[model samples]
Target: MQINREQLFRASCLSLLVTSLSFGIRAGILNKLGVDFQLDKAQLGSITATAFWGFPLAVVFGGFIVDVIGMKRLLVLAFLFHLAGILLTIFAQGFWTLYISTLLVGLANGTVEAACNPLVTSLYTDNKTTKLNHFHLWFPGGIVIGTLIVLLFNKIGLGWQVQVGVMLIPTLIYGYLFSRLDFPVTERVASGVSTGDMYKAILNPLFIFMFICMFGTAITELFTGQWIDVLLKNVTDNALLILTLDTGVMVIGRGFAKPVLKKISPQALLLISAILGAIGIYLLGTLTGNAVFFAAIIFGMGVCFFWPTMLGFVNTNMPETGALGLNLMGGAGMFAVSIYTMFMGSYYDRVVAEAHGNGAFAGQQILHTTLIIPCVLVVAFIGLNIYMKGRAKKSAAAVQV
Candidate 1:
């Protein structure tokens, strides 16, 4: 079947919205619960970690199902999980209950990545980098939407349950849209490419760099998204404003990156992004004033293109791998974040307990320390960038000769 651009865009948007809602929940909910529900550091970390627990399974399974079953079915399942999870969280009062609901949410979140990444890449076969970035904007955009709702709920003095429940509206809408849609067949089906060839391509150095970029991007972006409110609370009088500023700047940075990627080399873009990320994390950790907020804007400018750009790069450069590549990207990225977030959460828990006895620095500070994951990864990206560019040039020279 011929892919319709509008349908693809709509599907992509819905998929991203699903991802955004699931991933964004922890960020907005964590700080509020501390003040309202009286949750402590470890419990709060568990809340985020619970949702992330699906990452390993999602990355592993999401790709297989997409390759085996199809994108539409996976999406339907994802939204169902999301819908049920949100409903459960809306009513959950106890710790175990919250854990169950968030885990469901994480499952649905992984499903979104599973379905949408392939959908978008399949739709825009040529301009994979530009188009994939377009696809992922909704992830962050959903965070913006989720963040706003969280703030509004706080202003009206609503309960946490209501905030969780409200996500059901979007969940249902996206679910309904996906249900009626037709799915694209696996690229392997379309191209008659064998599975062995796809695996061989994925194992290549370039694809490995693709995985590395996703791993770094997930940790850096999520560390900030999940904990920025808590971080801002520590350093600023107006925590909400700071949180808003951080996300707002990120949104703006994504906007700027769309045009820049169109004009520059992906290698050049990655280099600039790494530098911006290092500076952004440093500022976030060390600076406390309005100045730090501005620094966040700069950081957002750096990292905005990282995720989609990497996906797009892989899709563009490795077209023969088909939907398998997108799934691998999602799987690798989510799996990386899952492992890293858990490690950071455990480490931060121990550090906070030792240094401050649960009172000195909040979970936010410890979480922010997770920024080191990406900081180190960003430096590595520089090396990856050099290797990729050199590889691409060599490939081109070989073709010419």
Candidate 2:
């Protein structure tokens, strides 16, 4: 059957947009849920953590099986889970209900990444890195849209449920788009690579190293991103606006990745990003006044390419691992966020109590503590950059022989 790659790309981007919209709205509403449910920061963190745990579970499993069951079936499951999750969240009465519903949404979000990452790479084989960056632009794009919706709803005094319901619009759009599309065979299957080989590729020491790096990158970007609203609430009354500005910078930065990559190798990019991220996080933790916005801009630029660039590096350098590699990389990242979300929540709660319920001081302290995640990335990525460069020189020398 003939397929239109452009149409498929659009469908995939829309699917991701739905995923990002759901995430943005969920993050925006965390405070509301706490007040309504009489939950503490730790409880709210647990609720937020649930939103990420299901992602790694589904992506790792789905990544292994996506080729066998096909992308179409997986996307269908994602659509249904998204629909059900939204309905459940709207009617949720307490923590358990919200937790289960958020898990379903996370599963849906994971499935979308599992299917679409491979799909996008397959469609744009010649320009995987550049196209992947373009594809992920919608993440921040959707966040911008979601943030605007929340602000609009807030202005009209609409409840959080209504903000969540707004996700349904894109949800239904992507479902229809996906249902009408045809999926291509994954690059691994199309190349006749054995399933055993795919699994073995993941065990390589280099893959393991990259996987560890992915965890740090994920925590640096998503852990801070998920909690941005709450952490910055005391920093500025215009927290959502700040969130919007942060993502807005990401949108622009990602759009320019192709140009940026022409000058810097992916490993070098990761190394530089880790350094910038560490600096930004430290500034965010310790600095105040108007400098918070400056710090956010630095952090945004640092994270703009972290997720997609990491995936692109793996895919480009380790094409033998295929979808499983991408899935595991993505899953590891999400799982890191899940673990840190709970930890940060608990840590914030403890610090707030010690500071006599001074959320501002507690937030600053928490950010200070969180700076360690990015600082570790700085050292790790430096080693990775040096190692990757050595590997590249050897491969180039071998090719010349």
The C-alpha TM-scores of every prediction are 0.90, 0.98
lDDT (CA) per prediction = 0.71, 0.88
User: In candidate 1, what are the lDDT values of residues 1-401, reduced to their tens digit?
Assistant: 55566776776686677667655555777766666567765677677776766754674587766878888888888888888888887877767777888888888887787777777766666666777776777777777777777778878998667767767777888888777767777655677777788778888787876776777776776656676766556566655555556666666666566578768887678767777876787676667678777766766766677777777777777776667677677666666666666666567667666876552264446545655765776677778777877887999999999
Cα-based lDDT at residue 96, candidate 2: 93
Displacement of residue 153 (Cα, Å) in model 2 is 0.8
Which lDDT tens digits does candidate 2 get at residues 1-401? Answer: 77789999999999999888877787788898999999999999998888788899989988989999998899999999999999999999999999999999999999999999999899988888888999998998888788888888989999999999988888899899888877889988988989999889999888999899888898888778778889889877877766677788889988999999999898888888888888888877777767788888888888889989999998898888999999999999999999989988999999898898899888887778878877888788889888887988999999999
Error of 2 at 31 (Å): 0.7
Q: How accurate is candidate 2 locally (lDDT)?
A: 0.88
Misplaced by over 4 Å in model 1 are: 1-3, 34-38, 256-258, 357-371
Against the true structure, candidate 1 has what lDDT?
A: 0.71
Locate the minimum summed-lDDT window of 10 residues in model 2.
Answer: 237-246
